[model samples]
Target: MPNLPDPLPWPEAVAPDTTAFARQAILNLNRTIFGFELFDRSLAQGTHTSASDAALLFNVLSHAECEVLMQRKIIFINCTHDTLASGHLELVPPERVVLELPPLDAPQRDDVETHLMALTDIRRRGFRLAFDQSVLTEPHLSWRPLASFIKIDISHASESELSAWVQMARQNPKARLIAEKVETEAQFAMAQDLGFTLFQGYWFAKPILLSGKTVRPAQAAIIQLINLVRQQASTAQIEDVLKRDPTLSFNLLRFINSAGFGLKHEITSFRHAVMMLGLKKLFRWAALLLTTSQGAGTSPAVANLAVVRGRLMELLAADSLTPEECDNAFVVGVFSMLDTLLGMPLAQAIEAIALPDTVVDALLHKQGLLAPYLELTVACENADDAMFAKASATLKLSSQQVNWAHLQALSWTETLVD
Candidate 1:
């Protein structure tokens, strides 16, 4: 073969990873999520750089948690003039994300018109624009017509000031109003009354545990199947349980037939699927049912996190544990977030499903063979350097191994969630 040119070399160290700590400001209107505003959460006390914004986009859209957290929803991202020109915006799909730009100083006054011209070019390329309420004031007035959304900080604005802003927003019917830092019922109601289209801040995410809602039959049936798999029940025995729930059986067959399984032929019977998938995969599917099966008030956020943790823990357990123990590790990871999903205590939520004593101990008290795996998985998520070091040392794992597993889990979630 003829000599070929070498590919471009990879960077020495990964970028600072600012996106790992970014939290989503999930915006809502009338109980439905409108979009997510990803804010950088650097523990360091200083101003953010252009790199921070770039890292945020990469995490949300490129390689991090975007696919799961941003499923079919609009995303609001903070963009300074520096970030806008950094060329990272071109990497994302403009249709799904709204670029929230901050106010730029009109140093030469002509720069204002110049900046708008640049923004107009971006808008032509399919990206929508968002501006703060300050854009309603003097120098930004010329920029206001270009805004698709206007964010008002309700925390500091006076009553009359909010009224004026609201009036200004009404004048621009094309602009959607968003109220941020809304903390209480009064603020939420006031924002609603004032015609703000989207609301954000503490009040929106206040967890309301669902104690009144009963578990759906299909969900309960899935739980039964998971327990049966754990008990090492025969395929015939499990088939009888699935027979009672046609909906659950149909879902299993459909899932096996879907692209997720990569099967050559569609599975028409539960037994055939069990035999095709075998026990290991059958249990894996059962475990996924907890996350994917629709029910009342199950938080996709919790489900997605659980899936990542479960897969990471299972990967870490490779070569060190039995096949069955590895399966338990997966169970511990995915079900660990049950408390957040069910809106109850972990004990109560886990009680609804039957799991091994080892898995239960890991979930309940963090004391078992699988407990360290769960702890390490969580430490990975929180970026706790000390815990990660300690957990890896205890498990005889290296940072490189954990990082590789973490990336693999994120990739799997991207395919599974969307």
Candidate 2:
């Protein structure tokens, strides 16, 4: 590694677990984002241990936000051999994932065969495979045919060594070359000259850490309310649940009166919110609340951000979408932070409730009419001019309109906080 300057220290108040994930973009020759390699940011090597691999997969698949992430672009995940055989592997859509496996350490011939057997099963399951330079070594040669991507660490490889590996991988026809660890212009130029089509490392962009504290909800009250709402129970019974938990009641009223709901007046009572939203939307609101409920001492910043996203997307779509689609857009925006809010495996939270297919598509699949609005809201929040321009263009909205809605949403969130 070239001697890069040291990065600023992590904030003292930020817990290690808040360093939940780090995703480094993988770029194609044209320098577009092809996929991301996700890492456990807390890990020293940024690689997953067996347990963490399963946990990461669980988090990725279950979180509504992560679903949107996977739907748009492919992701490369580092895996231990044990993770290859994990049932969690079966849960992911094979086409959207590429499992990067390390080669055996000082493998015996039989050890190669054992690993190959696992790889074959996984490959048959439809996941593509990526390997380090060790795949070019003779012992691992039998495993070569299954490779869809071969990554060469350009930082370590001599020009002649890189040339040899590139030539060998080219012979396979199916295996594309990735120049990993390309931290400088010279390394990138060298790899490009050698015909590497995919590149990773600090040259294009460093890994971006996504952090969030897990939300732990007091579920009994919320679950009962959801059940009651699901059964189309009378408003009295539903109100009973809210009355039992003052915090839930407070949160419900706060959310209902928020600008995104478009209420003509404040909904100070639980029964009023139910009557206004009707059963369908009321249920979604409650289900969403299940995840948003945070324990004491936990910051409300994430939930507040979620509401801002919800309202921003709603305002952006108000001119373009129907009432129902606008509401779905709000759900997509709020639930976009589902993984961080729920704190548990996403599967657990999502499986317990039902969402409209359109909301599901926008939240989980990043597809449907509302998805672009959600994307625009995020772009606006991040102040990403390029993405903001692209998403606004896709939706055919002017920048002035989006900026106005964004400022309005932030201002509205302040009211909720106060």
Candidate 3:
């Protein structure tokens, strides 16, 4: 057996249940999530150790039910200067991931050189690299040529200082500069003016509400399908509604044929899909369709939040609610954010669908058998320790159960993307 070093101290961040992982989007200039930077929300409050980062990657990739991440977006992971030499990251395919190595605190070429062999090995194996703008200075400069991306904090420098930093970064023409903390349109533009095409921040996720806004016609068609599925309408009746929009029908076929369904053969038509999947399956698919139908303008972060909420709520209710009630709990979580997703108020957005009284009540008023589950799920997302303690006790659940369920929910949501 190999000897190991003493355990590294955990960062001061509030401890999360061992099962939970938090993911945030890394967006590009066009306001789309180019990648997800995942970390231990449980460990987020405190400074992170490279050990934690390695563990996060292992947890995210080990789950087989979901692809480790979105197909099109790369996943950026934090790496310690030391972890680079630990050989812990060899299990992950470098093409799909980037190691965000922090700049050397000071130029100790001996210290930096110790890991250079491993660093160059990972880069040779296809792993890209990201670092702060500081890497362009000092002994770290020796490490700069290996960088594929450099992130400059918009808030970290004064306007004049920022211009200098951007100017300095130009020396590394091979590296793409990323502007982080770009929260508003003006800053985003400033970053672009300075020549940054990649960005990270929440500017795009803010709700774009407008007065007198109602559901779009496309959204209306989706709502109608939800109602039909709820009523257990015949296939022909459901097909009539589906035929109204080729897009809705096309999305349905795509989902049915998705890896989630694991169909051995392709489903070519609506009727064939219906017969193969049955009405119960169709109803579940329709519910998912309605929840996810708001696209293009919708931020993936918002949609991802809704899915996590729905999955968490359903998981929390599993032990206490009937099978039918569990389904409603899931629906409540998924639709809880529909008002935000649709850009219409909750009352009006939900009014278009024929959801069960319990699901509708929980989403609208937060009162029903399922409402407690919704509140608990929100508490988990926010990491409200007091609320989590109270809700878990009131529901007669243990920390272990909640942790297990929360982790499972996150894993399940990851699978929903593809």
Candidate 4:
């Protein structure tokens, strides 16, 4: 991790508010959780930077892509202490949400009391309370009312410590146990034996390359169409490519007219859209469409997460680089997770996609102009401050900048998906 300069202020460009983003994020969460219960809270709202007026903000933020529609299970969401205290819980359906109590710290005694009071009230109303990141197994802590679920982390636990924790869980038969960071098959099996009903970890959603075979032929054609558009091919040439696939042509026309594009005139033909959007803009949008289309069978939240990463990286670099470079930064950010998105190897994905050398190097080799930036982004996502510091120092970025970028990522994600 290298030190970097202060993050630049947020850009004036506002992201569209749409339900599509939220649906995508929720779909992604579903895939990340294979058999265990999964829950979500906007990172921004969780940090208390914004108020969640809508209960479905989490769902909205998760579904920005078609991939989000693939999820089939229920996911719990956290309601902030403030929201609970304000009695907003009355407006929310308790059955759909699991109010998560903030961690108890020495300075938060009063806040904890208030939260507990709210939780008790809500539970009486048929809502459930969940305890997150519960590493403390003290008897005093254990005496607190049983939660609907308890989240535990074994990242730092020894075998003896884990066994003790498991024994403790057994002691509380009324509560459901969730093991987070179950990073290996062995860990997952152990958790299952411990009667843990839920799990989350990189092992379940490790980024991999997508083989061309996995992608439907229509999707592959869309990718080829995007490549042609990227080359500044003429409308006639682009139309010819699009005409080769009727399904894509129809979808493209529908998308262009939808509220997503807000086109004043309804364009019924693919060639007409190509002529109207011109080469550059057409290509940019085509790439987006292609990527999003691939999201149909995957988790939309994961795809939007990639988009958030790209937007944050680009915004962070806005002040230090040329517009062209900033665009490259955005490309580097989104494509950073291509392997995960494609369900293929990173090297293979890059080989298949004809991205610029800088983007290619950053994604595949992680040793080019944008590699450090990508590294910083990953560290931030994992909340590894030490790695963030190293990247900031190396990139000459300020802590404020880093913090701002992180916050913006959260904020942008909230707005885009929610």
Candidate 5:
């Protein structure tokens, strides 16, 4: 791992009141998880300085547990020229991470040459580089060859313009084209036809509603198990529910033995696992099972996002809310995606499960005491700066706290593998 600078240059007082990083998935043509593009939601346009870029890098590479998760897939991070030259860039393994170099706002010939030198050095050190469509301009031609990925914002270009960019990007044999901000099925199809190899945006997370769709039986069983655990049912009763659904029993046992649990010995029986986990932990585990149930048409990314949201909400509310309210906060986070997961309206999907009013209010109506925490959790995932700042102010949480908790939640979700 590369070491950060001895004394980081970013000043404490100049930092924004809210600094939160959100990741947008970079998917392959098949719509599978390829990598994540991490960016700061609180940063306003044209405000990405060396200080802000370095802060983002520090937050990512600082966590030891996250290193394992990060190693599993490619990570795309936006970089300024200054960050490219920063020592922390040396700490990140070049193969696992792609440094996205943005175009200069006002291109000067001398400045462009200097920036190219920096890009060359970084690439020579084994780091892959990505550029946005601005690289298609004549002034950026010198930087094009170094690109390993080329991102084209589909929302900003017409078909002909996008085609031209795709053609230009293909001149670099090593570059893989990414269609950015693809929000609809049509955009996805057009990009696919344009020979784009990767995609990023909300299109994949959108719900495809069916008039008569409801929860699958296996999912309903998991919900039932969750409710039984929440009610603190007798061990025999819990075991009975598990016995009726072998799939749920297998999932429970598998979860207990997973690396996240850190259990030394495997407990084969449902009753044994129940006794070991107890009510509180078991209820949480069952809720996870419900989200991860093999529902048709649900993206794996959606399930993963739900878990991250739940954990983030719980952590953010830990210091302020009562223990029970904090637990409700977690529920609000996890079930926030119920509508998409179930392929129905959120209200309709939430009806299948039993929850406290606090959880229901936040999930369905975005009201109640836990609503602010939910807002903050979703704000961390969105690019809306005002929403993030407003939520932070409403909760009186600082940027450092929210940023730390968000990374912790991501690390926690990485521990739970199917």
Candidate 6:
């Protein structure tokens, strides 16, 4: 992979939005597992967005906060070889920060040893170290003495790999084992069975609408009504559809009367609100429902993930695409995983709704320009280097653009969800 450029000049203001970061942390962990460790990016000065700088900021800030909360537990933060060489550890109080060494590309033994030795010094000063995304088998274990924790990416681990991790965890009683990407109940169970204590992933809280199942039938009805309204059907025709679904009609009237529509007069019936809202506003609301309903039951984390992905993708394509095209890309990113979130198939979930041509194409077929962006988003979520590289190349996007998009997406998701 190509090296990403130094932090492109920070905008006039770094939006004081930490919500996306918090949300990603929550979604990544699924349930509220105490001691939330996050990658802090606020310290990157000027034009350089150094991974090392991010790691150091996380260690300093999160560690202090965790200690203040009376949690003596270690908060995991990623550190690169460059940051380690900079003696960033000297600035951080070691007892609380768990400096997680990210997987290096070349797998150099000498470099690894040198980094481990530096970590050992930090550990002796009361800091803990961990190996993140453990991919190298027994060879990586040589640095175990310097690590207080080991994070295994159980998502890609095979039976033998899992067994190896379990054996290693059991043998090293002093080190706590963490299982990353524990997305499903099965994964969680396996991690627990394997003696891993820390866990992360989206299984605990699914992305859902605020109303959840209560809104499903209404949502389906609303989509149908919107489709009819968009067709320029007569008021009576729309009314006829509304009359058939009294509950939906009643809810529509209620929604219109509520603060959402700032109407002084109480809308007594669905037809009245429909007429008052007009076709354009009605269509807009209906489209908003697709997003609102989808976000209902999701934890702050899951909601943030979708939001960031959508916004980042939109931002990336803003300069190249038309407004409509950009909007389609955003929709694709937001609705990409609706099936997994709703516990329904994607086709089934989007069946009744009418989306844009590009949105529909990307969602249903994963083809078109937006599809590659969506794929890149998923690849980032999985941290699949090969897939990420492939998607970036296919999209003709630079590595720097990819990283910026990922970070911005994560940040945006956190804010929107919150």
Model 3 ranges off by over 4 Å: 1-19, 29-33, 41-47, 66-73, 85-87, 90-96, 102-127, 133-146, 155-164, 182-194, 203-214, 228-240, 249-283, 300-305, 356-418
Error of 4 at 257 (Å): 1.9
* Lowest lDDT 10-residue stretch of candidate 2: 1-10
lDDT of 5 at 409: 79
Candidate 2 positional error at 284, Å: 32
Clashing pairs in 2: none
Q: State the local distance difference test value for candidate 3.
A: 0.72
What TM-score does each of the candidates earn? Answer: 0.67, 0.46, 0.69, 0.64, 0.85, 0.60
CA-RMSD of model 2: 20.1
Local accuracy of candidate 5 as per-residue lDDT tens digits, 1-418: 0111121222353345445587777788656689988877656664887777766666566556458546677888887788877676766567777888878877365588788988999899998999988887878899989999999999867899999889888999889999998887689889999999999887665444445786787888888887887677899999999999888888778777776566678789888999988898788777877776636755688788888888889888888889888888888888888777877787788786778988988887878899999888877776556778889999998767777677677777876767
Over 364-406, each residue of candidate 3 has an lDDT whose tens digit, in order, gives 7878788778777776665455666677778887655665566
Identify the candidate with maximal lDDT. Answer: 5
* Tens digit per residue, CA lDDT, model 1, 1-418: 1111222222234344434442334555544667777655442443566777776677567644347556787888777777767787777889988888888665645577778877887888888899988789877788888888998999877778898999987777898988987766678778888888787765443333445555567767877887787788999989988899998787677777876556677779889978887777777887877655535544455466677778778778875999789889988898877655555666777787768889999988999899889888877765455676678789997554565566566556646723
Question: Worst lDDT window (10 residues) for model 5?
Answer: 1-10
Tens-place lDDT digits, model 4, residues 219-251: 578667767765666778788878888877876
TM for candidate 6 is 0.60
Q: Please report, as a residue range, the 10-residue window in candidate 6 with the lowest summed lDDT.
A: 18-27
Q: Between the candidate structures 3 and 5, which one is better when assessed by lDDT?
A: 5
How does each model score on lDDT? 0.71, 0.69, 0.72, 0.58, 0.78, 0.59
> Which tens-of-lDDT digit does each residue in 216-250 have in candidate 2?
44565776777777688999888888888888888
